[model samples]
Target chain A: MNLLFAAEEAEEGGSGLVSPVIGVMLWTLIVFGITLIVLWKVAFPRIAEALDKRQRMIEESIDTAEKTKREADELLREYRERLSDARGQADDIVARARRTADAHEQESQAEARTKREEMMDQTRRDIEAETRRAIQQIRSEVADLTVLATEKVTRKSLDSSDQKRLVDEALAELDFAALANEERR
Target chain B: MSQSRKILLGAGGAYLLLVVLAFILFGSAGRQDFVPQEEFELPTWIELGPLDINKAVLYLLISGILTCVTMVYIAKRMEAKPNRIQTAVEVLYGVMRDNITRGNMNDKMAAKWFPFIGALFLFIWFNNLIGFIPLPTGHHHFTVLGLEIPTFGIYAATANVSVPLVLSLLVFFSYTFEGIRAKGVGGYLKSLIPAGVTGAMAGFIFVLELLSNIMRIVSLSVRLFANMLAGHLIILFMAGGLAILLGIAGIGVFLLPIGIALYLFEVGLVATLQAFIFATLSAIYIGGAVAESH
Candidate 1:
């Protein structure tokens, strides 16, 4: 009875394996069909959109950065050019100031030279005027002395007219003698 | 003719050819001797303990060769502008690339491992699909090199514990090597202990880390093997019930239709799921190996 039961159990076990296989296969097919449909329609599209959006955002950011960099470069170049222009203007101003200063220095030197020459000429004129005054006074004194000497040389009592004529003649003779002596010395 | 009709005709022709081949090869009375079963009282060639190397090796070789030829031919004939066959291949490639590889490992990493992962997926998928083709049903025998070899009509490579075990070991070693390469051995070992667990607890956590590391190999292999094996076993029982019911009763009432319906669904699901599970686990392992600590 046990042997017969074992044989029957073996047969049933063999047969039982078949139904589960079929059930699993059927379940697999249904699940696979649903998965494929859902994935194709919904999930795939959403994923693709998200990926595209990310790529676009990245590209836009890069482009914006590039544009900003270019603008900065342009501004920097302009600043440099302005700085150079300002330097050039400053150099021009310095050159003009130097030229003006040189001209002023030359004018001042010429004025000083003219003033010195005028002072020297004034001093020489004053010295010459002083010498002429002294020479004139000496000549007048010498004439009076000549008169007295003539009167003593005569050694006689005479009238006034005679004395005067004698004096004049004597003076004239002395003057002529003095002139000749000076010439000889 | 309509496009649908054209597709139907093509499919019908392929099915007829498959049926003819199955009948010619498997229908012979002489082939019964090659199927070695203690229950069936059949003879076989050399046996390795309980494992039949001749049968297993031949099946693997044949399956591998067939897959290689089909894939190579399809690859060569592929065009810039797709024909029907090319479109089919492209669709398969797209699914593997987008969903399996890219979905798990980001784009850059996917690019590195896509070829190997894709090949594995397609090979497993075709092997699983071939089991339902009605050719290699039940047991069969073939003689080669003066040896009688017993074999099944279809053998899911993933279903065999040894195959997944080998694949999982390969993945395990590969990730370990990657970790060591990316970060030195010292760093790799350091990485095993998560951050901020110090003092006496650190030692305990380290032990737990080691256990988890070992468990990765076990879980990867077992997950694939179990899923495939369970699927195959379920399919076997479904088909077998119809056969037994027909033998016992004059008419097989409700068994054939239900069995066939479930069989179809299970095959489709199992093929896709097995492929997905294998690819996902490989990606996870690789990702873990390369990931930086938080």
Candidate 2:
């Protein structure tokens, strides 16, 4: 405690280090009080208000940005959905057109086959009729040639009953049915 | 060519210049005092009733005026997109409001006390920062061209015990009043003890707590006062005080660089740090007073 005593003595001996000066203290209080009051009344409130306003502005901006982003996202989703629907409709239309085309092709092919068969039938019937006429002409020519040869061999004109008899014999000997069969083959 | 070599050469050159200057100024002078305690003594420049206008009061007035004007001006001109000075002011405001005041107390209490705490921080910080700057407030004077001019020296009003003492006293009373206001006198005293302690042990603890409470003023004041005073003294001694005292001014050549470094350190960190600590402690005291437990 001797040290404390020495320090106290030093303090008493006009040491400005620890000694309290009333005027300075009073002045400190006065100055500090005035500063506090001035700052409180004028400076601090404005600063606080500005800070609050800035904060609110920032929050509002953030909210607006978020809302816009959400709307854009929604629009994008809707557009994608519509595009997908359009694509699906296009696919269905193509599929239906393909089906119609397939049906039309089948019908046209069947009609062509039927027309071709009827034309082939008509062509075959025409050939058969022409062959029959030609065969009849050949038979009549054979009969007439046979009659003329008989007259020439006999060296005299035969009577009607004789010619008839000769012609009947010649016709009986001829195979007209076989000739027509050969023409058909 | 190497970085270290370059730095060494630069230091050597500076040291040589300082030695030459020191020798030219004080080579023939005898021993001188490093600690001139009288420098702390303020002489009245003006007297009005009980008030003696002096350098300490002058510094306080300047600090107060600057605090008020700078804040009010910045507050008036604030914008959403801040410029450089506005950004700096905003950063300081955030530090005072968020770190010091609101860090320790509830929002209500913080709002109520933010102005006092902010002013305290600004006032103390300005005083501490200006203390490192050499001003024509020295007790000594030199006559140049038949006119007396005060010498330029560094002094801080915070280094004066009375200034911090008064501020600390205010803090002490404010917190004490808050405690009593929050709880009745008896309840506030009872709350000083820890929650579990009872009987005589609780009484002993309460007395100890009360004493600790009282010591806040000394701790708060002395902490600020001693730090500032010590920083200034170190700068003074290292700059030339020791060389002057030892009758070898040439040694200041080596000490001046260290003095410069310490000067930067004090101005850069200690000034702001001390103010922050003072305001933070004030907040904590006030916050603790209103809290349910000690």
Instruction: Give the winner by lDDT.
Output: 2
Candidate 2: tens digits of C-alpha lDDT, residues A38-74: 8999998998888888999999999999999999999
| Candidate 1 lDDT (Cα, 0 to 1) | 0.58
In model 2, pairs of residues that clash are: none
- In model 2, where do residues sit more than 4 Å from their true spots? A1-10, A154-185, B13-28, B33-35
Error in Å for residue B88 of model 2: 2.1
Write one digit per residue (lDDT tens) for candidate 1, span A73-137. Answer: 99999999999999999999999999999999988888888888888788666655654554445
Complex DockQ per candidate: 0.01, 0.55
Chain B alone, TM-score of each model? 0.70, 0.93
Docking tier of model 1: it is incorrect
lDDT over C-alpha atoms for residue B272 of model 2: 91
In the range B1-294, model 1's lDDT, one tens digit per residue, is 999999999987876666566445543322112211112211223554443333333334445556555665665555445678767766776787787778767577776766656655655565556544544323545778997664444445455555555556667886788778878998887787888888998889888988988888778767776776566555554544323322332122224445577677768786677767776777677767767761
